[model samples]
Target: MSYDPSGNAFDFHGSSYVALTPNLRKLGGEVEWDNATKSATVTLNGKTATVRMAEESVTVDGVQQPLSGPSLVKDDVLYVPASFFRDVFGQSI
Candidate 1:
């Protein structure tokens, strides 16, 4: 099946881990996943946020931390909490 951004877009059917992709580049969002740390870094407008896999939470600029829900991974891509873009980056999906 083709990946649909509108349906099951938020990877809610598996582990809490989610992957981000370049398709979201239009939102001016950048995601960096560190294999060693198993942490995902999200950057927007020069501001950066780090989310630790073990914690299943995100910290923005060392403050304003938020807990994330379930995440999905398919085809080596990570699908994270959809609200991440809006709540963290201030971007309207």
Candidate 2:
């Protein structure tokens, strides 16, 4: 949130969490899961992002960074924090 000089405040809202596969598909990216590691590999434009469940971080092209929130798997589907799609895909999901 932010406020202008006139004391008018601005607020923005978006999903803090996002389901992986469908969201990635929107960006023309491919996602693959690994049951053993409880992680998913996201491929987009030759770049790979590894999203691990239960962790608050993602490894993109070998570089790991903290996520906006922790990730988790629900009903066998991987749900990631919105930050990954926003920051990595360079667009809103």
Candidate 3:
């Protein structure tokens, strides 16, 4: 799923998924954002994963997880794969 700056949604990655709104909580188990570090933390099943905004990839328990699609940062907001939520948050779409 891909959402442009204009809020237009598309399945550019062929996942056929689209988020109606940017609801971090609904997409994951627990979501935390650190404004100072510009990073987001997602905890699932007692496992915590941290994603740095400026970084090209994210780390799960210190192991790098390659992203399948391009991450879009627009207006200071980062849009990543909803699968990331499922992987780290143990939630299903």
Clashes of each: 2, 0, 0
Candidate 2 error regions (>4 Å): 1-15
Q: Which stretches of candidate 1 lie over 4 Å from their true place?
A: 1-19
Query: Among these predicted structures, which one has the highest lDDT?
Result: 2
Alpha-carbon deviation at 6 in model 3, angstroms = 9.4
Off by over 4 Å in 3: 1-24
Q: Could you give the candidate ranking by lDDT, starting with the highest?
A: 2, 1, 3
Winner on lDDT (2 vs 3): 2
For residues 1-93, could you state the per-residue lDDT of candidate 2 as single tens digits? 222233222222433566778878878989888889888998987889999888988998999888876775556566676667777767676
lDDT of 1 at 52: 64
- Model number with the top TM-score: 2
Worst 10 residues of 1 by lDDT: 10-19
My TM-score estimates for the predictions, one after another, are 0.66, 0.77, 0.59
Residues 1-92, candidate 3: write the lDDT tens digits.
Answer: 34555543446557433332354545545667788987777666677777776454677877887655644555656666656656555565
Query: Per-residue CA lDDT of candidate 1, range 22-61, in tens?
Result: 6357666777789897677878877788866545467888
Model 2, C-alpha of 69: deviation from truth (Å): 0.7
Residue pairs in collision within model 2: none
